[model samples]
Target: MSSKQPDTGRLTEPCEGYLVTPPLLEAASFADRLDHALTVLPVAAVRLRLAETSPETMKRTILDIREIMDRHDAALMLDGFPELVRQTGCDGAHVEAEDVAAARKILGDDFQLGAACGFSRDLAMLAGEKGADYVAFGPFGAEPETEGLALLTWWREMMELPVVAAYSPASEMADLPLPEMLHTLAATADFLALGVTQDGHSFDALWQTPEKFLPLFAETAKD
Candidate 1:
């Protein structure tokens, strides 16, 4: 909650949204690749992995991402550790359902803590009760593609927590080709949780979708 720090959290009411490019262990070169995408997108934040190869190696990757965020004025989101969240100066931490209470206790009131709520309204409510800054609603229950839209709608109405809808391309590849997917995705909720598969992580691939979708998203958002 350092007001002095730039607000790099995801762009949502309860939480800020970022286009998180997950960390890659083998692809040390991927940082720049991901950074390039963040540069083009109107991303509020970026989520980078906390590779646990070794303490020293982890530190190096964290530093690299921090430098990228610093240059972009973007916030960093970590799934590695709460300690790393504080140490790396990331804006927030995303924790699984079982870990939410513990993470909340660890992060305290200052940090942004987002939780995975599955597809249950009770789960989302529990996350809110435990002080989650926002709640993500997938990678489970209904499939992450077409069925996910219904789940997001459910979460939005049933739970007060800000919602994120996550989708893996393999599971949702058919939907990706449809312009309505982008339009409905942008219109549906506060944040869109797109998965970065082996192929989709590329700048050409990722940007291709957005280049087509942003204009469509703008038109849809107006209507």
Candidate 2:
């Protein structure tokens, strides 16, 4: 692991959180839940990922959540929808590694463009070179990859672009607390992009009660 510290210039605090939309975001009720989450948690960004739906439906879904995100001052990043970013009034777009350059052209310099690089350093570097605002590293899954951590450590130590340590829990680890998982990731990642899908876990509980997990972020900063 790299000894150098991750950059905190863009964040209000030393460590910050980012939220990933649940798979089923088209539901009207989910927007309310998202509003509650953002209202309570210190989240800087929200990646809106939706299942395949009609263009009209997608726009409506984004519009519903956009208001809440805007009120909270959280950047709403549309997943794989660079073209619709401006039309939908989104803050930015998150694209795959292969589409970084195209997305950048579509979004221009002012918008926040992020890239999902998976575990490839070459792709991550390429995204950065192509003017990505940040690079996301992994799903990391139940068995976290040493290489993924190394990549995050290296990116944090060397790059100015932010790094999001993403986690999508495997079936075996669904029972673990979200905060507990976040605590482990906070050691190396500047931002945590957590999937809101843990079994028996409530998003309300995670955000409303900061005492349970927010301190873990503060603790990581000290290290």
> Which one is best on lDDT?
2
lDDT of 1 by residue, 100-121 (tens): 7888787888788877777666
| Segments of candidate 1 deviating more than 4 angstroms | 1-17, 26-28, 140-147, 171-179, 198-204, 207-213, 216-223
What lDDT tens digits, residue by residue, belong to model 2 across residues 120-181? 99999999999888889887765657788788877777787788888666443423365344
lDDT of each: 0.59, 0.72
Query: Measured by C-alpha RMSD in angstroms, how accurate is candidate 2?
Result: 5.2
lDDT of 1: 0.59
Ten residues in sequence with the least summed lDDT for candidate 2:
1-10
Model 2 residue 57 CA deviation (Å) reads 1.2
At residue 196, what lDDT does model 1 achieve?
56
Q: Give lDDT: candidate 2, residue 207.
A: 36
- Candidate 2 global CA lDDT score: 0.72
* Total clashes for model 2: 0
